[model samples]
Target: MKLLMMAACAGLTLNTAAAQEMSYGHAEYLNSCAVCHGVDGTGDGPLRDLLIRRPADLTQLSERNGGTFPYSRVFATIDGRYAVPSHGNREMPVWGRLFLEDDAKNYGPSGGEVVTTERIHNLAGYIETLQH
Candidate 1:
């Protein structure tokens, strides 16, 4: 009946939304992070050796972080919040602010915290899938 049709349509809509969100994250990684991190998240890109502290081997993150990847901490570090002191300075750009600016430019008005949160979540999700 009409109720069933409506539910089906709603589900389809949600699925489409989710797909779009995932695509954005994938695109973002491909466009920005992949240059340094490598497409396979191995940190073996051409610029890897140029970095003073060396890019992280993301696939081994869990082993490096006590058998559990501290995702929140990783997200914070990627977003340039929790600085690695031994890295010798903030070498990575603050992605949170960069994403906010990009969102503002794309949406006319800034999406503010929501967009930042989504970007972080999406990036984190992408990173989680990199674990070996």
Candidate 2:
């Protein structure tokens, strides 16, 4: 029936959209975080030794931090909110604003904080998947 066919098409379309969004998050992680965190999340990247404080091995984050990944803490760090005085400056760029700026350029005037939050949530979701 046409109704059945339409329902199937809608389901497929939603699945495809989700897949694409996840792919974007994964790609963003590879391009942005892998240089410091390593593709395996082991903190063994080439640039790790050059830094004063070594990059945290992301795979062990939950174990190291009392058996919880502390999603908000991780998010804050990525957004450059947690101050690391020992490092002399922020080790990571603030991605919240960066994502917002990028979205604004692409989505006309309506792109704002909500888009940034969605981007952060997507990236966070991708990071959560990295946990073993």
Local distance difference test scores for all models: 0.77, 0.75
- Local error of candidate 1 at residue 48 (angstroms): 1.6
lDDT of 1 by residue, 33-132 (tens): 8777888889886777788766777788888888897798878976775466787776567887787777777765555557776888878777878888
Q: Residues 17-106, candidate 2, lDDT per residue (tens digit)?
A: 887876666777777788888887788777888778788777776787888887887777776644667867866678876777877888
Cα shift from native, residue 41, model 2 (Å): 1.1
- Give stretches of model 2 more than 4 Å off: 1-22, 81-88, 108-110
Native-structure RMSD, model 2 = 7.1
